[model samples]
Target: MNAPLDGVVVLDLTRALSGPYCTMLLADLGADVIKVESPAGDSSRRTGPFPQDDAEHLYGGYFQSVNRNKRSVVVDFRSPEGIAAVRRLAAGADVLIENFRAGVMDRMGLSYESLQRDNPRLVYGALRGFGDPRTGASPHVDRPAFDVVVQAMGGLMGITGPPHLPTKVGPGIGDLFPASLLAVGVLAALTDRERTGRGRFVDVAMYDAIVSLCERVVYQHSYNQAVPTGDGNDHPLLCPFGLYRTADGWVTIAAPRDHQWQALAKTLGRPGLGDDPRFATNNARVVVRDQVRAVIEDWTSALPTAEVVDALSAQVPCGPVNSAADIYADPHLRIRDMLVELEQPGSADPVTVAGQPIKFAGAETRAYRRAPLLGEHTAEVLGADAPPTTDR
Candidate 1:
């Protein structure tokens, strides 16, 4: 069966997490992605969490997670011959993606404007800390940024944890979210190119993406002139919509609506609380959130985590605070094929990585190919007689 993007070709010049993640999504959707790397290869090859028994440690798990389903070709861009080869590849590709600092591509003479001379219909996508100068430039355009930097500067950390204690999220949404948005922009640009026969420049900034993700705080600060503070696990807008303690562990319950609240109250053997004026409506409950929380915890404290979930499962939206181990053992994940096993190079055991989240009705859902070895496809792609030093 043909995939959604079977005929589209992508020249991927991204390293690290953000750029690679964007290309990975395209590759998963059946785009012919050719990962262009330097002679030293992607820096992620050295990043770890290596297997215990693997002596070679060829590629670490971090690299494997986001780089599957793509071919790698090494090119020494410092040389004229290498630069010529890259231009040739870009001429045939439908899309090109990069995550370098703002001016690095221009310095290397591989800027979108230069490449468009060869392929006018090519869609160019860039993910950066601030943004590319082709779009709108910022004073901090030259500064380097990572996931944590944007999370803090974009207002996510300010409202994440307990009061007075800012916390970074466990996952690196700072990088991944921007990459996801860039993928959308690339697709949109590709669609527009088909209509106009002209490609466009698309860029996403990590800071801008995180700020968009935290838009609630933006509206609150603008409308009420109030600075939002952390309220631990509870939500500011909805009561009974946060983590709760059970006898053995933690569970989350969201009973903000009237029917759900009434069902929860009855399930806890306190149906009268549903009608009590102090806690009857969501607004009233928010005014006395402490009392509402205490009342719920008093009943849940006497029950184990499983019992609490079982009792409220049909009545309210509730689930346990799962750890990694719990998630690995979850039957729902197995049924949905969310955990995929892949054979890593030089390792006898298979490594498990996350599966693609987006699903299509008839399309294959998993990455069929594994991440490539450094420059493994270099000679085949550049032609066998190209140059010896070109295929590091």
Candidate 2:
């Protein structure tokens, strides 16, 4: 089936996570995402959770997950011809994406300003540590950054994990969040182009995106004159809305609403506790957060996660704290088509990656395609006249 972005051509100059992820979403919808890799290929190629049997090390899960549904052409940027070939590709492309530091592309002569002159409607998408100077100046523009740095500086780590510990989130949300926003920005620019007939530059900073993700911090500080810190599995304003220990494992519970709280109180065999002024309203419960936690755990700690979920699933929002294994075993993900299987080079059977979450009603979603091998599409894309290697 023809997808929404079938004819859109995207020049993917991103490496690692952010840029590739942005293009990966586009490719999943049928965009022709041409990933231009360096001589060494994307560093993530070696960053893996690789198959134990694959001694040659091929590519790892990190690269495969985000780079799926795109084409790869290894290019050696060291060669002037390679750089020019990329510029030529940019001149005719609909979109160009990169997650380099602000000035990296400009130094390579593939700056948005020059490329836009050739393809006036090209949507220039950049995901950077700070931001592109075209949009705004940053003091740390020259500094390199990664997930940990952004998570810390953006106030995410400050409010994440336990108090005073400031732990990094398990997943690279600092990268992924900016990438997702850049995809939205690129689409918005494409939409605007339909009217103006000109594409605009789209910039998303990792730091800025993470800050936006923690928007609750802004209002809490302003409204309550409070400095938010990690509350240890509990919410600051909402009471009894956090994780509790179960006999087997942990289960998350959120019963902040009055009726839900009352139901929870009744389920715990203390219906009178729901009516107590100290715990009647959500506001009151917040004032006695520890008491609420102690009360909930008193009942939950005796039950297994599954039993707790079964009891509270209907009236209260609750579920087990799932691990990767639990997620794979879940029937809900299978029913929703959230797990997809595709070929693995050395594995005996196909391996699974996440399925596209964006769905179209009544339309058959595209099947998952494995990520391209390095330079796999070089011959097919560039043909006989293709620059003799080095489009890095």
Candidate 3:
């Protein structure tokens, strides 16, 4: 039952996805994450894939997915008393995470400088569109940003889809990636505090994180004078390292190395293709990527997805392109505990959310509790003596 962050208390003043995701990871690792929400509650509470029968429409899957294993304490941030209550929570917390605009926390008089005075060892983390002025200032610091904005601006969208048709990625990596980096930064800051006995401000910008995620584009542009553009599913550097069409569905195949390429050629009953002058080396294959793709698809298009996987998976990296339904039915993911079932707040039916990816050797890292209802823990956390506050 003992987890890595067993004794750590996190005052989570984040809404939507980014900050909540960071705190969710901490909460999964056994941190006492107290989510401080405004009276209206997190915006995600209303956004949902709601059950058809639930007329009252409690919290939706979007809210539940990232807010699990945490306690919620709703406070009216505009009220002086509510601010005092947050200060009390922050004073007793080991970490405070927020994803509001740069000056929002400072205007509320709850900046890291103000909180660290009460708890010198507190790790203050901020996830923002640009970055906090305390770390570095930018012209776009005040502009609001979303997943699409950062994905487009950070070069991910540019290299995502087919040529001349850039596409946004399916997942919200713009926000989630920054959140992940902030979590690591918070832990690193906490580690440093053990020696220096001082906490520090950690900031992760959505734009910065996306740029870091697309690190390859930077080096390639510099070294080759190549502005990376979308190349469909095929990798620019490696031939036959992309999705291929099977008879029934699509499957990804990655066999760029010589031995793997030879094995793939042999498996497809085309061993001579591996030694052919135009397809012999990886560079040659890349130079003639369309021909390589045609050759591979020519073999795969005759077989079902399962058959293709069975034929090449043992020898090369290959997998079917799984949809949500496919993932739900996948025996491998089920055995690995990647799909977890949790009870809905109001409905009798249980919903399945993603399980923790980081597996500890002996520690419990699963989602132990459902997402809390709005203001569910306000009284328990603030104590009976605390002043009454609006829970809108």
What's the number of clashes in each of the models? 0, 6, 0
Winning candidate number (TM-score): 3
Cα lDDT tens digits, model 2, 81-149, are 788889888888999999888888888888898999999999999999999888899888888889889
Please give, for residues 18-111, the per-residue lDDT of candidate 3 as tens digits: 9999999999888999998887889999999987766767799999899999999988898888899899999999999999999999999998
Clashing pairs in 1: none
| C-alpha TM-score for every candidate | 0.96, 0.97, 0.97
Which model, 1 or 3, shows the larger TM-score? Answer: 3
Return the TM-score for candidate 2, rounded to 2 decimals. Answer: 0.97
| Runs in model 2 lying further than 4 Å from the true structure | 390-392
What is candidate 3's CA lDDT for residue 334? Answer: 86
Per-candidate local distance difference test:
0.90, 0.89, 0.91
Residue 204 in model 2: lDDT = 94
Candidate 1's C-alpha runs over 4 A off are 364-367, 384-392
